[model samples]
Target chain A: MGATEMREPSFLILTALAGGPLHGYAVIAEVAQMSQGRVRLRAGTLYAALERLAAEGLVASSGEQVVDGRLRRYFRLTDEGEQALTLEARRLRENADRAVARLRTARSRVAPA
Target chain B: MTAGPEAAYRRLLRAYPASWRRRHADAVLGTLLDQADAEGRSAVSVADVRDILGHGLLARLHLLLDVVPGRVRAVAGTAALGSGAGLCLALLLLGEWLPPWAPPSTREAGFGPFLTVGPLLYAAWLLAVAASLLRHPRLARSLLGAATLAAVVLPHVVANAYPYAGVERPSSTALAPLAVLGLLVLAAPPSRPSPAVVAATAIGTVAAVGGPMLPLWLSGGSPFPVRDFFYYAYAHHLAVSAAVLLAAGLLAAVAALVARRPAYAGGALLALLPWAVLLLAVWRRISTQGMSALEPLVVVAGVGAALAVLGGLRALGVRVRL
Candidate 1:
């Protein structure tokens, strides 16, 4: 059966956690801010990503603590995670640069401006 | 307790397996309640329900995949390797591969169907098993498959062409050789998705253990007619049983390569213990009589027991490299 997929919001999630370890709700809020309110990660979507990331060794549990009378489990990026995120960031930047360069060439050719 | 956001979300949280819920439910519930508080809401949203149910089932599937094929098939592969090797050893020990007891026609020169097929398949299996041990599993698999196909065709060649052997119609493709063919196929491992590997392993195992005994079953618990090829006596019974234990150890070793702990091997050994004992217990009688009715049942039971033991280990927080 074809699986219904949640679009991977791992980049923004990793970017949010890059600053430090954060609990589930704090991550949701941080990702919202990081994405400039463009990629809103719901609780279900966030946990699913976190679970997959944890399984893949890209994320790990930092600790659990009590915050505001509720238990909050904190997650941190591992060294491997940092490496993966760095590689992805570099790749994405390279592609963006290439695209931008191509667009300038196209613009110059179209109107000679 | 009251019908509020926490209560409603708690109901939604039931979608996850109990173990998963235990680990992550409190955090997830906390997050959901926090989201609800920020939105000034008291009821669950449609999107929340959809994601929860969907991801919950997905998580359960992931958990099942981790336990089932991951360890069991690896163990089965090892066990099958043992069985394949054990069969070769048994044949040599019993003098069945060119058995001295056979009439002169069944000798190496005569090339009676089993005489030729048994040694060839077992030799290929031994080589494949060696290759697999050396971490050349892909090469081993190719050799094993080629050997099995060759074994399948050889019976016809030896039986039909070699009329000088004096046996009018040879059932070389019948029981024991078929089992060995099955072993070679099984020990080879399949195209290597865990499920496919497991299925191929299961079929090979049935053929290895049951293929030989099917003739005995048909013959109404009397000695089968084809003694020149494979002597279905004490040697055969002992070999089959030994194969079970040896193969169990082999797969467990493969698992240990991933687990890196001797305890993983111990788990597989413990699983096969009953089956080995059962076969040993009945083999003497089987050698004297036709075939033990319990042989097939014993094999299936042994495998089930092994899968259960490993699966239980997985549930108990013993992690494998899957």
Candidate 2:
């Protein structure tokens, strides 16, 4: 709620919804694909995260469609959600950049020595 | 066996609150079925079942926390602090008023005539609570931690220095207030208190205070004066169980009203399952002995059950609204 550190599942869920509105299963599939199958979002965890994100205005109901006689609700990121995602992305990028920079500096020192 | 996975999944989903199921059950179930189909599995995986059950309950608890008002949390926090302090004072007074013929275990650990270590330690705990209330949470937390540590250590020291036969060292009840205060300070955010913290504090305080008092009341009474420690322990457990049930019921009723959702009330009733089982056990024990010590517990159980049923019915589409 305070824009604190987002958990990996939540971050990935937001990432899955970044491209377009996706139904629950689609989002789960996309998240698995995005994480290279390292992180599989279960139905319960996915829904819970979606509910919290929705409550926080990071996501919203785009629409609903029936596929194979079962209802599938689509969720899309709101403007606020997109902004949050962008900020989180920037934060992660910076952290990665700093780590890489430190690694490069250490490598240069070791090589010269 | 054909419907095994779906049925199992549905049963697991029962862990979720009714309101949540009303909204997302169909879609979630569909997704689960889709995943099963995609993975070439015909049954719900053990991992999926565990995930559903674990996260479902947590989700409901999170929702429950969300419905509890900030004002209610603050009030409950204050009451917990007050009750903790009151219990300390009562224990100190009891030590002072212990009759000469009382059991040696009931005697004060022979610290001194007026000023003893236990009272001083409790006084320090009170100061810590006051500090926390005054917004000096860091200092208060440290002091409380120290006080609790002292409480834990002092008993061992006393046991070694002045060992007495049949002297049961002070129970966790003696340190409950400090523990509650510690929980409050730790769980409370800088800007606001979380609902989980408030609920835990409220429930913990009730259990800490009511647990001891109920046993005392039952044992101190006329019809069935239970003097033995065994009976006292049994009565104490019954009282604590009843208190927990009553508290859960009350919380559910209030949450239902505040959230305007009958599901919260139903959840509260669900919380009373253990209490009901405990009540039956108490009834069976007392009924065998022709004892009427169960009247109070029965009343509490009745009230809790009524509240739960009312809420559950309302959630199930009953026309009643309050």
Candidate 2 wrong stretches, greater than 4 Å: A1-3, B1-4, B63-67, B70-170, B178-322
Name the lDDT of candidate 1: 0.59
Best candidate, TM-score: 2
lDDT tens digits, residue span B5-66, model 2: 77777887888989889998988988888888788888889889889999988867656554
Instruction: For candidate 1, give the lDDT of residue A85.
Output: 79
| Clashing pairs counted in every model | 5, 0
Q: What TM-score number comes out for model 2?
A: 0.52
TM-score of chain B of each: 0.40, 0.38
Candidate 1 ranges beyond 4 A from true positions: A1-8, B1-3, B69-322
Instruction: Give the lDDT of residue A113 in candidate 2.
Output: 44
